[model samples]
Target: MRIYLPTTLALLAEQHAAGAVLVPDGAVVAEDDSEDAEYAALMTAADASAVQLAGAGRRVVVVADLAAEPAVGAAVPWREVVAVHADVEDRPAGADPDEDLAWFATQEVPDLF
Candidate 1:
């Protein structure tokens, strides 16, 4: 199952160093394999990321695939991360949170920070 983990850049850096990001329960999960479903999931995750942002920063979503549905408080290993979706530029304060995110490959994750 694919999971979208809402997170912040600071946290992302920590995760990068730690090699895994601990995920909370009830994270975004697509209902089906359809593109629309996955998109909805990503949007939902972006919203959740906004809430967590609480201040100036771009939205971020960690895309990872797990063996099965994740349990409560699961940890996503860095190796499991396939891609990252984040704002190409930091959104201005009070800017539209609906701004789209850019896709970055896992190898490019280090350059994101």
Candidate 2:
């Protein structure tokens, strides 16, 4: 399953370097069929990161692919992040409701911090 993580640019870099993104707490934020579902989840994560803006200026949506075995539920506890979609290159600065996320591709994220 493909999951979208709302995080900072620096944290993304750290995850990239570490080869894993760790989810210490909170619910698993991911994309659903509804475009609204995907957007809402992403926005919720971005909103949560507003307090920690010093490390990275813009909110980043990390697209990761996890194995289909583990289902997301109250009983499931996810920790390490493994595979990431290698298509999305960059995340734009600031929030824009007009910006379309469907076009995001796999590539190196630009220095937005």
| Model 2 weakest lDDT span, ten residues long | 69-78
Total clashes for model 1: 0
* Every model's TM-score: 0.91, 0.52
Candidate 1 structure, TM-score to reference: 0.91
- lDDT string for model 1 (13-94, tens) is 9988999977854379888888999888888988888778887788889999887767767778899998999987777667
Model 2 lDDT per residue over 29-80, tens place = 5656576886676555555444345332544555455565333321222233
What is the clash tally of candidate 2? 7
Best candidate, lDDT? 1
lDDT of 2 at 67: 60
Predicted model with the maximum TM-score = 1
Off by over 4 Å in 2: 24-31, 54-56, 67-104, 110-113
> In candidate 1, residue 70 scores what lDDT?
76
